[model samples]
Target chain A: MEALFFEKLKEILEITDRELSANDKFKEYSEWDSLANLSVIAMIDEEFGVVIDNSEFKNIQTLGELMAEIKKRTK
Target chain B: MLLSTHHNISIKGLAVAVPSGRISVDSFYPSFGEDIVQKFSEMAGVKQITRSIDQQTASDLGYIAAKKLIIEKNIDTNEIGVLVFVSQKPDYRSPATAFVLQHRLGLGKEVICLDINLACSGFVYGLQTTLSLLKNSSKKKALLITADTSNKTLSPEDRTMIMLFGDSGSAVLLEKEDQGNAVFQFGLRSNGYKFKSIITPAGAFRNRDLPNKVEEWADGIKRSDYNTHMKGMDVFGFSITDVPNLIIDFLEATKTETSHYDVVALHQANIYILKQISRKVKIPFEKIPVSIDRYGNNSSNSIPLLLADHFEGKSQVLKILISGFGAGLSWACGSIAMDTKDILPIIITDDIYTQGDFKSSEHD
Candidate 1:
């Protein structure tokens, strides 16, 4: 599930050149833009069937946190 | 969430109007490269959008639509006992825009007037309010106008917004009839917590001192505080999650089935967003009437515009479900059944209230 999460993030954000790790701050990436952020949210809704709203999303700093938040919501 | 069904109300007439001026995606090729322009165009599902001219206000479009409906339907303006103007753009900050519309429409001095400041979700909100008020009042006929000139507040250089917003206004004439067509059910919710998700910081008194000087924003877009700033990601999350969930609940509460509706007219927030909502509720993509491709997202007017542009004032019974979401961090859904003839054809106008032209001499 964790591996799939990172995979979907990379695909949605269209990140190339650099690898995305669990600890990586996705916002710091050059590939990240407003569209990228929106795509990630949509990707999460499609892939995990849970929504992390804007306020909760602000506290999520890394790919690992994003995964954990989705997990928490599903549980 | 407020969920209730109102009876004895049928939309007697409907009309939507836009300015004759148009901004096509092809026109943006010079600012952004052709490749970028086309890519954005595909993403937004926008071919072109109508825009109001410098002298034309959102109210002008609303006035035109209302006037057209009255003239075409041969409505007795004296019978219109209430006027509800819902818009993010009003002629003045002082008098509610409804008063001005009332005067221009020649509605009686005793007409009830109101102005609601809201954006995208306003059509649903306005419909419910107009019907509820009319239900309790002595008069049975009322006019609901939802208009927005959101583009006027957007930064022209902001690619995120410039191509997405189109200005429009709509008028729905409602009357209580002994043999009304159908009941109107609405479910609404507001998340004031996310109010800042879409905002114009300096326009009002709180941030009155904020200058209009363009400054590099945190997102690297240069814009003044006066421009409407939208947190795209936040709103996207809300649109996908909160909006669709409420709509699903609304469907269940209203006992509306997939086959019940002839059309699912959604606020054209984003084509992808609309697709997500439809998928969640298991509504087919074909069932949704999409005007975004040609008209862009014209704020509160999306629902009426869809009816006007698609149905074109012909007589036929249709079951319609409409959902509008945005900007208050607000979302609402409503369903109604009515004859298509009441849904008048969309009109185009560049007319402005020339009497409103205010000029003050430097010496005065």
Candidate 2:
């Protein structure tokens, strides 16, 4: 599930790097923006059928964190 | 400024000549793909557009349009005193296109011929310049010609510009005849700093020797440097923010309201941007005349081309609000009053199939 989530994140955000070291921030990476955020929101809704609020985006700091949240919500 | 306060110059004649090859949005869709073309057409409000595939340069299109005007008006070529050729695309860099056109139209060597390098905001600026020249000079008749051949500059991969632009030209003959079209208040503004925001990266002195560097940016194809490059989101933001303010300033200066004008002809940039402007200014959609669907954005000629098409054979005192906005981050809008009946008939030959009839055509 974690690998699948990482693959999905890589595809959605077009992230090239496969490995992420500890303390790496997703926002600090090049792909983070309002457009990307909206895209991610759309991806979440389409993939998981989970309607995440705009406020929830503030809590997500990394791909791992977003994947965890989606897993929890889906469960 | 010493001229009489209560005087006006009218548009004596207006004519448009487009390329022989016409491509409707329906027929054009297959080249770009149905989904993208449909979205672009819907967004730009362009139903049909004309192009001159056989003609290599935009000057050819301009010459055709000029010829048509001269023939239709039955005016002697010697009568033309001033010729203003407005286009970003000229056949040569140094020699003015106006001169070429002057010779083509058989206008005498004494005629004052010049080129104004502008696009979206060109028609209004050309009009303003021509009017100023006419006011001061002894030139009795002036020809304002706006033409562009964007396809030559475009790449097949360039969906944004390819779907948006069409080759077209318009010739407006200004003479000192009684009961001519009235040129009302005009508002012109530009921000040159944003010029790089919408421009081809190569060509001319900047990238003449550095072919490799240009190839790196434009990906081969020397003509790629000729095509227009626009940052769509930035242009949209600029249009939405600046256009309304300029319109308000124009209204204030002219002492007119939105409801006062009979028809508003906007620079056919895109349907979405125009819609946003209409909403911002609270102008009814029906009040605005749209020709973008049939004719893609024709740079400086969009407004005049539309007017020439709409006013043809229609006998009525028409008060029109004309505005054009585009590259150079420029915009110009104004009002003109004229009798629509003076213009000849305009026919849409290419892409005769109406919208939504795409299913019948295999091109769809």
Candidate 3:
């Protein structure tokens, strides 16, 4: 499940899992703009059947945090 | 609810006219930065848009399209018993634009003329109304003109609207025919509760007190009371949630299956929204004809524009499912079965019509 989640995130963020460490920050990515933000949310919903509000997106900053949020929503 | 016309009325002709001025998304690279422009282009699924010049208006384009249809199809002006103009952007605030068109088109004085103030859903609703009028009355013909010059109402800095809308107008000629092959069934709906999801706050009487000045909003977007504002996330949610269900209900109401129609034309809101609707409705993406990549969202004119663009110079029996949803928070979906001969090739013209410019060829 972790590998699959990272694969989807890597595809969305346009990075390889080798480059996407848990500590890697969204701010570090050049693609972290409004469009990517929405794309990530849509990807999560489409892949996980979990709804993430725009407000909730700001609370997570790193790859680890985003994964945690999705894990909680899946739970 | 599902509704079907009681009498047979055939669509004899259809024509769309867009202004000759074309603006490519890449043209905005200097203004919006290439990165943002590219991102927006990917997200909105718009490549280029046609815009009317200051000298042209929605009525101008619609007039041109109607004239072309009437001339090319050899429709008699005196036989057009009704002229309905469906637009959110009319030529004037007082006199209905349809009345102006009646005079400009040289229709007889007895022709009924009126304007319906609607935007995205205007075409389907206009088609339903025209079908009902022709079905109940002795009128043999009606001209339904759906147009939008909504590009004029936009703020270039408003990222939500600026990249999404284009200007266009279309004319559809409907004639009463005995045992005509046209069969129309419709599903219409509106939710005024979510009206604020898309609105122009200042031009109307209720919001007239507010100043229409563009101000920098959050996330580098700018807007004003005069400009159209849309809550992008809310609209996306509403469309994804409502549109698919509407299509499902419409199919059930019309007694048809998803695979029944030859083509489905949803309002050219954007490629993203249309594709989402198609996916949710379980229709193949190829079945949904998309013209937004070229014309942008021309509001009510989009469905006919899609037909004109897709079926131009083609001849075949077509069962088409068309849905239009937007402003008024309104939506209408319907099925129309017609022949390709009924759809005229799209005509792009820069000609701005004036009084006496359109004379019946019969007079010549």
Candidate 4:
């Protein structure tokens, strides 16, 4: 699940896979704009059936945290 | 939510009038910069849109479409028993726009004219209302006009709204024909609690304290009570979830097979959101016609505008499923079938309100 999410995060953020660690702080990325946020939200909903609120997206800082939120909701 | 008319109310003719002023999405390059403009064009799916002139109002465009429908269909003014104008941007804040339209069109005194305030879901709601009124009544024909000059309500500097809305209007002739097909099977719902999700915060009475306060946000865009504001995520979430589910339920209630319909015309909101709904509903992408790329979101006029723009030239029998969701946080979905032979080409004009041709005037 972490690997899958890592790949999606890389694709959505337009970054190299090596740069996207599960513990990496995604909010620090310069490309973390509304489009990236919406794309991640859409990807999460489409792929995981987890509806991430915009506020939640803002609060989430790391890839691991986002995955944990998805897991928490999906479970 | 399902309502079916006992009397067959067929849409005999349909037409739309778009203002001559055109704004290409690419024109935003100087203001929004190339990257932001490109991203917005991709996100909003708006490539080009018709914009009404400063002097124009919703009534002006609606009148043009209505006049064209009346003339093209050869509809007698006296025979029209109902005139329903659906608009959120009516010309006057007090008197209903429909009454003004009735006088301008020179319809008889017996005609029942009403104005319904609605936005995105307006066409479906207006159609259902028109059909319900025509049912069991002595009236044989009704004229339904849906128009919106939503562009006028947007903040010029707001990133969220400026590029997303367009101005346009449509007129549909609904006649009770015994030979006509059953008009609509509808599902409509609203959540006023979420009304703030998409609204003009200050222009209305609720925000009378700050009716005209304009402030620049941190993003450097200036906005006031009069400008439209939207919480994109909320609107997007509601629409993508509810619209697709409502369409699925609507189809089931109407006993329609997914494969049987010819077109699934959802409101021209956003290409990404529409694609999301399409994927969720398992409907083919091609089946869902999109005009937002060309027309932006024309509010209430979207569906009829979609029809007049996309299906005007085709003569095939059209079995379509339409859903609209937006301001008022409202939604309406329905299945409708009609013959496209009566559909008229969309009229693009710069002509504003004119009593008659000056050259042909008897007084002249």
Candidate 5:
């Protein structure tokens, strides 16, 4: 599940990195913008059936954070 | 700027090029969302809109129009001294569509070819520009071509703009002749503040981004920004608020009244907008020539294309008050006259190309 989460994150970010450090801030990356937010929301909704509201974007700032939220909601 | 001296420019000939694929309101209406199509039908009175196929671009349509005009009128290609192409969709950003058209038509190298990037108000503005060019320069004959392929810039989800536009081109040959069509007196106005009211929010200076940004927008599911976007209410307000005043101003300047015009050819933005403006300006409904019902707004080609369609094979002394408004927050109104008795037979159709496929004639 961790590997799958990173895979999705790499695909979404178009980054070469296979793993994200826990403290990594996704927004600090140059790829993050309104378009990236929408893409991430779509990815989350399609992959995990987890609906991400616009306001909740601040909570899921990193790949680990997003995966944690998804696991919490799915469980 | 006002003209110190008025020069009579003759529309010696006219030709129109429509896409081969045609769709009636029935077939085409379903493609657009039902509500939007219904609203357009109600407003523009367009029962059908002729559209182009993938192989045919806006310049192609212009070329076709010019070809037909030259053929039917038996005018030599070498005689055309100036070529003005009025289009929002040029063949390329660098070389003007007029250059392509001039090459295709075998027009001489001496001919001055240029393109104008105006949309809905294109015909009137083109006329105004052509008149100035003719009067200033020693050019004797000019070809004014107005064409638009709104489908290239529009997405299927953009119901408001999609229903209002059709792909087509028209050509009018203007020559200096005494006792020709009535001297064209124009009232033109543009307000850049409302530029965003109608635009494709990509590919130009304000929206230009790196190649990566374009790729991002392209890959995204939502492609609204690439299509023509108009705050419908704002554009409607602009049209209704400004058009009547502009018409009145033109009438005042020319010292003429509505009764003097045998027909009024206002931009076929939509039926409701036309009717409202007609009511506001106190022009009788019958006096207004509306091709919007059959051909959705053909952008720059709307007025002359409508004139070509309506006046084909008709003989009468017709005084026309034509007005066009859109896109640049631009508005232009003018008056001209023609004896339509000797005009050639012209065909108008509602064939539109969709998703790179030519929909066979639904109207015929």
Candidate 6:
């Protein structure tokens, strides 16, 4: 699930050259933007069938947190 | 129950007009760099957009479309007893823009002239109000005009919006034909608590004073209090979750299914957003005609513009579902049954109401 999340994140964010780590502050990425944020939310929803609440999504900072939310929902 | 019903209101004709100035999304590559912009364009689903010149206003676009529709359909102008102009961008702050359009369109004082300050959800809401009024009154018809010059409100530095938003005006003619039991059903929703999700920080009475300095934010975009800002994350959640839920509720309440419609004229907000709505609601892609790839997001005008793009000049009957959601943090959907012969092909016009510039001073 983690690998799939990172892979999709990379693709959605259009981050080709660099690898995203779980600890990486995903929102701080140079490519990370409003479009990226929307894409990520959409990506999560599609991948995990989990609709992330707007406020909850905002509080999430790290890539690991996003993955964990998916984990919680999927489990 | 959020559902509202009106009977015997048939859409007589629909027309949309765009100003001659065209702005292509590809042109932004030079300023923002090729790679990122390409990604943005692909995600947002904007290729080129029709823009009204600075001298022109939203009502100008509305006027041309309304006139064309009136002339083409041979609609009796005198019978156009109600004119509702829906847009956030009005010509003047004082008089309702509908009154201006009413005068320009040769509508009389006895007519209903009003303005609705709505953006994306304008179409269904406009239809609900106009149809109800027409049904109650002795007047046989009401002209529902939704137009917006979104380009004017955008901040150049705010890349998220600059290219994605477009300008155009649309005119939908609703005739209260007391026959055939034509029924229109609508369900609308709003979240004022999340109103800040999409807002212009200044330039209104609430935020009247524009900051003298443009501050560079963490995103590196410089904007003052006057520019519009959209919280993409919040809007995405709203669009995918709230918007489709509203549609689903409307369908369940109305006892209709997504597959039942020949066309689902959803707002051309983004290609991704459109797809998400499709996935969430189970509406097929083929049934949803998109104009955003060519026209960008024309605010309230998107649904009608989508109709004019596909069903224009074609003669056929269609069971249609129209949904528009955004800005006001509002969303609405309506089921419409109409004949395609009533939908007019879009026309391009550069006409501006020059006197509106308000430049000349009286020699008193």
Q: Which candidate number would show the highest DockQ if scored against the true structure?
A: 6
Candidate 1 wrongly placed segments (more than 4 Å): A15-25, A59-61, B34-36, B361-364
Q: How many pairs of residues in model 6 come into backbone collision?
A: 0
Candidate 5, residues B1-364, lDDT tens digits: the string is 2322246776777777777555566665556556545545665577777777666678878777787788887887776788899998876677787887887888987787888889899998888888778766666788899998887877654555555677788888887775543577788889897788788887766666624122223323234455666655556656666788889888888889999999999888877678767877889999888888777888988887788778877778777899999999888888766667535555443333233232576446
Model 4: per-residue lDDT, tens digit, B6-109? 44667788889999888998898887788887887887798988899977878888898999889988889988888999988887776798998998888888
Scanning candidate 6 chain B in windows of ten residues, the lowest lDDT window is B355-364
DockQ of each: 0.64, 0.04, 0.30, 0.45, 0.01, 0.76
Q: What is the full ranking by DockQ, best candidate first?
A: 6, 1, 4, 3, 2, 5
Cα error of candidate 5 at position B249, Å: 0.8
Residue-level lDDT of model 4, residues A1-75, one tens digit each, is: 877887777887778636577777887788776667677788898889878876676688888888899999998
- After TM-score superposition, the amount by which residue B65's alpha carbon in candidate 6 deviates from its true location, in angstroms, is 0.8
| Chain A TM-score, cand. 4 | 0.87
TM-score of chain B of 1: 0.96
Against the true structure, candidate 4 reaches a TM-score of: 0.92
Instruction: Kindly give the stretch of ten consecutive residues in candidate 4 chain B with the minimal lDDT sum.
Output: B352-361
Better of 2 and 6 by TM-score: 6
The Cα error of candidate 5 at residue B1, in Å, is 8.4
TM-scores for every predicted model: 0.93, 0.75, 0.88, 0.92, 0.74, 0.95
**TM-score for predicted model 2 compared with the true structure:** 0.75
Categorize the docking of model 1: medium
lDDT for every model? 0.86, 0.71, 0.82, 0.83, 0.74, 0.86
| DockQ head-to-head 2 vs 3, winner | 3
Clashing residue pairs in candidate 6, if any?
Answer: none
DockQ-derived CAPRI band for the predicted complex in model 4: acceptable
To one decimal, what is the Cα RMSD in angstroms of model 1 from the true structure? 2.3
Candidate 5 regions exceeding 4 Å error are: A1-75, B1-5, B25-36, B178-181, B210-222, B347-364
lDDT at B130, model 1 = 90
